[model samples]
Target: MSTSDDDYYSDGIDIRDLPKVSLHDHLDGGLRPQTIIELGEQIGLDLPATEAEDLADWFVDSCSAGNLPDYLKTFDLSIAVMQSEQGLRRVAREFVEDLVDDGVVYGEIRWAPEQHLQGGLSLDQTVVAVQAGIDEAIDDAVRDGRDIRIGQLVTAMRHADRGLEIAELAVRHRDRGVVGFDIAGAEAGFPPSRQRAAFDYLASEYFPVTVHAGEADGLDSIRGALFDGRALRLGHGVRIAEDITIERSDDENVYVSLGRLAQWVKDREIVLELSPSSNLQTGAIERWGDEMDDHPFDLLYQLGFRVTVNVDNRTMSATTLTRELGLLGDAFGYDLRDLESFQLNAAASAFLPLEEREELSERISAGFEAADNEGA
Candidate 1:
C-alpha cells in the first residue's frame, strides 16, 4: 500500500502528536507541491506536473527508481525553483511549518547551498535567505501557540570541489541559524575523503560533522566518514549492518558478531540517521530485500547503535516522522515504549549543547509520559 501524509497510530495512540526530533531531514527534498507549482510558474521552468496534487504524485512515482542516481534526479526540478532568495525563503518557511504540523519540537534542516545560486544569489545570501524564512516561521508558529526550534546543516556535495567553500560558509553562519556541516550526494565514487580538506577545516574549528555514508556505499565509505571526515553521525548508515554477521540463531534468541568497523560505531554510539522508506526507494537495502522489513534499521537499533529515525525526504517518500515510525512499528511490532526509545535516541543525538540536549530529553520523556497516561 502507498504511504500517505495521513495520521498513523499503533495501539490507539496517534504518533503525530508525539514530540520528535528530526536529524536527517533535507531542505530541498521537502518542498510543498503547491509551492513548487507556483515557484515553477514564476521561474518559467517546465515541471513534470502543473497541479499540486499531480505534482506530488509525480515526485513519488519518479523517485521510486530503486537507485541513488535516479532518486537524485528528482532534485533537479526542486533545486531549479530554489535558485532565488525568495524561493529559498518560502521553501524554508514552509518546511518549518510542515515540521511543526508533524510534531517536531526540534529539527535540523540540511541542504547544499552551492546548488541554489543559479539566480545570481551568493552562497552566503542563500544561507541568509533560508535563515530568514526559518526565523519567520518560528515566530509565526509561536504566535499560533506551537513552539519549535530549528537548525541548519549546510551540506557540501560530494561530487563537487566546493567543500572547503561550503564548509567556510557553514562556519561563517555558525552563530546564525546554521548548526553543523554535512557532505551529501552520490557517495560511491565521491567519498568523504574527496572533501578531506573541508573536514580538516571543520575539525580544527571544533564543528560537528555528519557524512552521507553507508546509504549508497558500504563499509569503506562509512570508515571514511568516521576516520577521515570525523563524522559524529552517519546519514542513513543503514549499510553498516553489512559488517555484522549473525553467527547463529535459535527459536528464542539470535547470536551475532560485529566486524571491527561496526563494533567501533556501536561502542562509540555514533548516530545512524536511518530513513526507512527512502532506503527502500533508493535500493539502499536491496541487498536484504525490496521491502521495508528488510531494512537494517531494526538490526542496528537492536544492537545498541545510536539509531534515530528520520524522514530524509518527506515529499519524495510521501512520509513524515510519524509515518516512518508507524511503518517501523507495524513492520517490527513496536509499541509505545519502543517508539519512545527512538525519540529519546534522536533527542540525545541532536546537534545541540549538553544542557540543551538534556532539556530535550526531559521534554521527550514528559511528552511520552503524558501520552502513556492519556492512553491509560
Candidate 2:
C-alpha cells in the first residue's frame, strides 16, 4: 500500500479520492517548499536549499532525526518565513488548497499565532491574516467544484508563558474562524498544569481544547491534559500505550490489562490524534519499535480506543492523510472499513458543533460508500 509519486491506493481504491478528516494538521508544518523559498528570500532569510524539491528533501532528512527536539528544529525555518501577513495568508491559503488536493473534506489547521507576530502583526491581525487566506482558499475550492471546510485551532507554545493570553486570543476570534485552543511544543517539562490559568479561562468560556500530550511525554502529561487542561482531544496521545500491560499470549488470544488511566480514556472515548509518520519521526513510538508496524495504533484500535490517523506535519514527514493511511494499511493490513472508521472518529472528534460533526460523518460515510461501490 505504499504511495507512489505522492498518490496512494489500497484494495483497488484510490486512497487520495476517499474523503478524509484531518484533526491534527499543523499549519506551520504544512507549507509548500516553493512558498518558503520565495518568502525566505523576501525576508532575506538564508535557506538551506533554494530549489523546492531540494528544500522538501531537506525537511524530510532533517526531521527524520528519530527524536522530538531534533525533529522540531526544522520548524524554525518554516516559521521564520511566516512572520508577515502576506506570508501567513499565502501559507494558510495553500494549506487549505493542499488539504483539498489530498481529499480532505474537513480539517483543523493548528498553529501558534504568537510565533507569527514578529513581523509587526498583532495577535488578532495574525489570526485575521491566516483566516483571510483560508477564506480565499475555501472560495476558490468551491468555484472549482470541490467542497471543503476548515477551522483554526489556535495554539500556545508550551515552553512560553503566554498561555492565558493565547487562550484569550482564541476566544476573541471564536466567531472569526477559530474553533479551538491548544498547547504544543516541548511537552516533557512543561506540563499542562503550567497553563492552568489558561485552561481555567478557556473552560470558563466554554471553548474547546486539545492538548499535545503522550508524544514527547508519558501518562502524567496525558492525565494533566485530561484533568487539568480539560482537553476535548489529545494531540498525538500515542504514549498512552505505556499504561497497557500485556499479561501473556496464547495460541489464539493475547491476555492484556489496562491501567486506570487507559481505561478511563477508552471508556470516555477520548480521541487520540495518531500521526503514523510523525510519531515514528519524533520517537513517540520508539517504545514499541522504530517502524510503522511497531505503532500502537492497531493495538489501540483493537481495544476500541477512539483513534484517528493524521499527518502531523506534511512537510516534515513528507506525508498526507492518504499516505499515512496507506502506511497503516501496509503495516496492519487495514481494509476500507478500517480506514472509514478512522475518518468517522476524526469527524466526531472535530471541534465543530454536534450537528456539523454529524453532517461531516455523513459526508465521510457517503464518500467511502461510493469508493466501496466503485471497487466492488
Candidate that scores best on TM-score = 2
**Model 2 per-residue lDDT tens digits across residues 29-133:** 999999999999988999999999999999999998888999889999999988988999999999999999999999999999999878899999999999999
Per-residue C-alpha lDDT of model 1 across residues 160-254, encoded as one tens digit per residue = 88999999999999999999999999999998989999999999999999999999999999999999999999999999999999999999887
lDDT of each: 0.93, 0.95
Could you tell me which 10 consecutive residues in candidate 2 have the lowest summed lDDT? 1-10
Give the runs in model 1 whose Cα sits over 4 Å from its true position. Answer: 1-5
- Superposed Cα deviation of residue 273, candidate 1 (Å): 0.3
Q: For every model shown, what is its TM-score relative to the native structure? A: 0.98, 0.99
Give each model's clash number: 0, 0
Clashing pairs in 2: none
RMSD of 2: 0.9
On the 0 to 100 scale, the lDDT of residue 66 in model 1 is: 92
